[model samples]
Target: MTIISTEPQLMPFFSDAFLEKTARKCGFMERLRNIGPQSLVLSLIAALSKGNCTSIADLHRQFNGMCLSEKHTVAYKPFHNQLRKSAFADFMKTRVTFAMVQLIENVLPPLPKKFEQFDDILLQDGSSFNVHPDLAGFFPVASAH
Candidate 1:
């Protein structure tokens, strides 16, 4: 598939060295094992891009499928455990931040004079939802008595 071909293009943006460094910095990598940080990150990106991977199990399958050999394939539990770590979020955040910085520096043009003063521009949908009464203790809401 084109997925295999496109991976080489992505390597320039998300290099193996950078992925390993960030993973180590974020405490996601203690020591390199069967499932390296690069493999995990690339597999995740590829799986998500396909849009068919709806669960962790699906992701696990995709990871194994991407492996070059049977020996490199990880078990479902180990794969799940790797992603369950608290540092997983930090690891992903670092990667995303790096990518965004790279895009801003190399790809995107400079902002106009008026907008240049702002560090970042944020847009949010002003959507709100009511929590169930039973969840009030867990999710407290502000009220005007």
Candidate 2:
């Protein structure tokens, strides 16, 4: 069987300096240096995306595999507890969303001139939505309610 690597690929969008700046701004970094906030965030993303890591134990395993040095390791409970904090949760959500937007902006091709006429373009994916009662005259419902 071919071995698959779960190590972080060092994404261009998530640079070390960028993550560090975000972590510092969010107050995730204090005095200790071994397990930096950036490493924790990157490891979490890599584990969930690559190894299909589930429980805190699996998180530890995935993180350990990505580590270059074997000197220090973050325990599962501490890592879990840290992630549970509201501040960290908000920070991760904002940063991840920002990263995704940046990635799309960088990789996606520019829109055609016809589409570019609009100030904004929203692309949503879901089942058809019901029309408001105000527009019932214009658009009748397909099925009887």
Candidate 3:
């Protein structure tokens, strides 16, 4: 598995200018404020990269901690309000699409001849193991022991 660092490496994919433009396009940035698109996106990326973020409250704290300055810190209510908006979903979808496109274009190689017939290839792990008796109805085993 490849691990992407959250610092200078992520900057290429989410530059300040790109974040600003996309936020405006997605209606995520209705007005300039302490929690700008760049800061929010960078904070989210950093927090997620660390693998400790479990909830929106965690993200809110991460955002304040990573802000450019003290003046940029935002209260949890305002931060949660921003996230509850529909624009937030659109913004995240747009960013994920952009990142996927960038990964395919720059990092991934072209498909081989054997797979030319397929437009896309999705890989899934098929390994399975026994589960607790309580979950047997939910996740049936391949064969009884």
Candidate 4:
């Protein structure tokens, strides 16, 4: 069985450090130390592939699905449930805050120059987006119970 979903294999553009640093700063380190940030990102990527980015409920479903998966880190010992529990809900709230900051950091590129010529136009600025809050799980379950 292909336990490790294909999303991680497919999306090679994502940066590991970004997720790690963001996750750590946000306090996901304790909850996902052994699983690591990359796995969390990978699982999140896999689950979010099934839903729309703009839907708030979709985020809930994706994380729940991934956490329930045997391959996901939470499966071995499902401590928190952002969907059906309060503790997890608070935890998720913090995660969401950090994730949003990380996301914005990712999409908006850093300012390149201190100044630009007025007469001589310099074309600058590009757009990038990975619009899924659900891309925040470890692996996935080998089988759903």
Higher-ranked by TM-score: 2 or 4: 2
TM-score of each: 0.68, 0.61, 0.66, 0.32
Best-performing candidate as measured by lDDT:
1
Candidate 4 — worst ten consecutive residues by lDDT sum? Answer: 136-145
Rank the models by lDDT, top first.
Answer: 1, 3, 2, 4
Relative to the true structure, candidate 2 reaches a TM of 0.61
lDDT of 3 by residue, 50-133 (tens): 898899999999999887778878999999998898999999898988777655565668778899999878875655555678
Instruction: Report the C-alpha displacement of residue 10, candidate 3, in angstroms.
Output: 5.8
lDDT for each of the candidates?
A: 0.81, 0.68, 0.80, 0.49
Task: Please give, for residues 1-145, the per-residue lDDT of candidate 2 as tens digits.
Answer: 1122211322533677777777677776555466666677778888898756668787777777778877777677776777777778766876878766755664578889899779988875535666677877776653223
For model 4 the local lDDT of residue 67 reads: 61
Task: Name the runs in model 4 displaced over 4 angstroms.
Answer: 1-13, 52-76, 79-145
Candidate 1 lDDT tens digits, 1-145: 2556555545655678878888899999989999898889889999999978899998999999999999999999999999999999999988887666644565467778999789989875535556667777776642111
- Candidate 4 lDDT over 24-75, as tens digits, reads 6655555544455565555556666766565534443455455645554343
Q: After superposition, which runs of candidate 3 have C-alpha atoms over 4 Å from their true positions?
A: 1-12, 111-145
